[model samples]
Target: MKSSLTTIAKHPSISLLKSCTTMKELKQIHAQLVVKGILNHPHLQGQFVATIALHNPTNLNYANQILHHQCHHPTLFTLNSMIRAYSKSTTPHKSFHFYSKILHFNNLSPDHYTFNFLVRTCAQLHVHVTGVSVHCALIKHGFEHDPHVQTGLIFMYAELGCLNSCHGVFEGVVEPDLVSRTAMLHAYAKCGDIEFARKMFDEMPQRDFIAWNAMITGYAQCGRSRDALSMFHLMQMAGVKINEVSMVLVLTACTHLGALDQGRWAHAYVERYKLRMTVTLGTALIDMYAKCGSIDKAMEVFWGMKEKNVYTWSSAIGGLAMNGLGEESLDLFNSMKQDGVKPNEVTFISVLKGCSVVGLVEEGRKHFHSMRTLYGIDPQLEHYGLMVDMYGRAARLEEALIFINSMPIKPHVGAWSALLHACRMHKNKELGELALEKIVELEDKNDGAYVLLSNIYADYMNWEKVSSLRQTMKAKGVKKLPGCSVIEVDGEVHEFFVGDKSHPRYDEIELKLEEIFRCLRLSGYVANTSPVLFDIEEEEKEDALGKHSEKVAVAFGLITLKGVPIRVVMNLRICWDCHNVAKMISKIYDTEIIIRDRSRFHHFKKGDCSCKGYW
Candidate 1:
């Protein structure tokens, strides 16, 4: 025991052995030394107990023995070690108590490392007051100029959402290094202040890939996809090579832009650049292709990746489900389980989406229950909403209502919206009224909910209720959101809205759509013209229904894309008449049409919709 203590005192890396990072190995060594009667050595004992406390399964009894039996005032190294150990302990409050005791111990001075550790501990515990106090102390102790201390301060204030304090710390540093600057940039970006983050990036003498990534990510998060892509182009122009982090951000931009051409360019760029096969970058690529309306391309990328993780499967499954391949998604989930890839919360979200699409009531119920039973994951509110939506879509209104009523948390507008849509489908006025009441309570400004309820009343031929609802909407000044759709052709996005004649080619577009409708009428495509919100003559109603936003967009896509398969993406649900017309358009034009509506994907191929007359 005495010889080991002497050996440790002379060794510089002895503390490394005591670090929690090496706890398991250290425990084995401790066992060996204990057999040789070395656990009683005072110096080694303090170090050993401190190491154990820092690690999991803290050894409090052994820690107390060394604190009491050791010298009257422990060494600075010993005190710092104990402080770090306690800070990471289950009782973090005890860490500050130990810090207070450090001042009482003579011959010990807290170093920069000690302050940095204290700041990180405060951040982890979310003790903002204590963290601020530590920041003031660092300045008082003339340690504010230290780069490591400044970096820690920036991270702490950022975590607390105190951007002003973070900026002050960044400016006060004697000479900010790259690490400190990067931390400051990240601080601003994370706090939702991307403008300030870009300012910092522009002011830097040189920007590393990390700094570039931070700004790109910030722009992507703020939904400025154009700016993010522009920055990517600027980085290349400035001779900064794109790496995995940069690629991920750019892929996210493509998803938002629906820039399939740009995404394909990026895919080719990745192969040319030969960035290492990282899971994160691969997952981002899969997600990008999926969202850009290329499910087959997404699957190709998913299968090509050698190292597939939970996120990889989740992304591919989510893409398949979103593309109306619900059964395929569930099959992939089962295969993932067989391959021993444990599904995460995100994976469950994809699975739930599949259930919602296919109306798989039993499978949905089983997976929802397994979230708690098999995986021990407590269901979140989002999961509850999805479950309710699944049951509602299946027309199992009783189960859906029971689930809604029994939610541990208050249901959101989405849950109630699901019930309202179900009510519209099943013509259940009682449930519809109940859902409308809840919807108003949840969101008074929900114009869509009001419109849906009014439509329901109209469907029931309840003219008085429909008129009353419209009067209320007008009195409250609640304006309904206009449904819109967009189609991209030849590098330009052409948008359309109901009864809109804003396009330069409106006359030609209208004639083309009418011509398509004639063919549809011949092919048994009856006009289900009930969705139009108007009180007008029969001829006007037909005209209004024929000029729906999606039809305009599809007509534009067909004229521009010619004989090629056209994909039109809408920001709202596709009305029944539009769905039927899309089918007939595909058959008459001998072209495939893919539409992504609010509910799910619809692939109209050769007079057949992939939804199988279900959705």
Candidate 2:
């Protein structure tokens, strides 16, 4: 039997292990090694563990069982293989158990490879303390200077939100290579230090797709969408390889700016280059289109996707809700469940928002309750807020208050803000004041709540209260956010603030707006000045209403984009006066106007709105 084992070890079944395509073949070889009495051979044992650990469809459980129970003594190579595999696995925290085992074995010591995988595992775990301990181990082992290990440290620190530590690790490198530098770039970008990221990116003698992606994603996430798009264009001009990450980041930028023309160009570029439409890219496209007020195009993308995940379904459902197609959103949510995609927390938020948008009060209640009871998802603050908004939008103010009072957790400012909005809409000064009180207790600088309550007072002709509210806002140093609108024309995004005249062609836009309102008046359109919070002269109030950001953007769109739908994205809700004007303009000019505000989309066509005047 010893002679037979020697012969098998000399010949070795390592080749067979390497060629394994499935777990069954691997198990057969493992059993053969056992029968041949060479399974405990150090070299053969390492090979067997590696094969199982690095299999195409890895069987970590089998490898783990063999390491813990079957193999009486495992080599450092065998344990490192297991650690590397577990580091990349879903249960990365399990890698620590193997690291503990490595520490116990005085005969074996961790190498740079071990530290690399262990640092990555710490990153995956997102446990800062564990990551610091691994860093210390790497330093103690004198492998901290390894470029790969340093890169891993950078990533781990970045993931743990220890940006200063990331910088320290990066600075420790004598002459960082491109990989290490790129890792540092990613660290800075991930930590929201885009300035440092860009500096690193520009200083690099050579830049790869990963570096470019980190920079672009940083810009997109930091609300610098214009800069993100600009970086993408520069990336193309620099002749860099564009991949799925590039497309997704650019789509996010387009979504933020409501740059549909550019977004459409991105979609065309994806098809023109034949880049595989991954689920993430597909979801980003849906989000961009839906947010840019092209819901039909969003639905088209949704239907064309061959694969759908929970996020994809949620994006589509939320898109429908944003476009004010509430019933369709609910139907799609049901279909998502039917397709076996369990709804996550975000899915329920979209579902509830859909209910609130269309005033599906009972349906919203059912879904909200189902979150905790049926799906085991605890009702988060956003869900509770959506329920309050739904009831409030339906004019069930008493029920909304009751629901807020009955929350299992402390009521957030969102719930109170929703009730305050409903009070402003219904001109309920008493409840609006009550909601304002609650909101002030939570967030003293909640400008929206104060604005809504002030509007309510104005609606009731309580000019003295409105003045007092304004004085209070001043005393509290709370200023209302200026309304801003973005419009895309000829692939360039133009922004407008309330009463802005910053555009070079502001004169032309103003002239065009004058012509539009002239035609609108002829068509019996009168400015509804009730939304003006300040008690000013009626004529001055009308003037203020006309200079709203959306009107300026729409006027510019009409000037530049003839015969195309004028899509406007705003930072605030559309006032009743603006909604009426948009409807009249759609009829008078025979045009389609789509306005996406902070709340929902208003699709105005032929003297009607898709919202049916519900919002």
lDDT of every model, 2 decimals: 0.79, 0.89
Q: Give the poorly placed runs of model 1, Cα more than 4 Å off.
A: 1-142, 174-189, 193-208, 335-342, 490-511, 521-529, 534-549, 613-615
Model 1 clash pairs are: none
Q: Could you tell me every candidate's TM-score relative to the true structure?
A: 0.79, 0.89
The digit string of per-residue lDDT tens for model 1 on 129-167 reads 889888887778778788888898999898898999998
Q: Can you write out model 2's per-residue Cα lDDT over 37-134, one digit (the tens) per residue?
A: 77788877887898788784258999998888878888988988888998889789888888888888988888998999999899999988889988
The stretch of ten residues in a row with the least summed lDDT in candidate 1 is 11-20
User: Which model scores highest in TM-score?
Assistant: 2
Global CA lDDT computed for model 1: 0.79
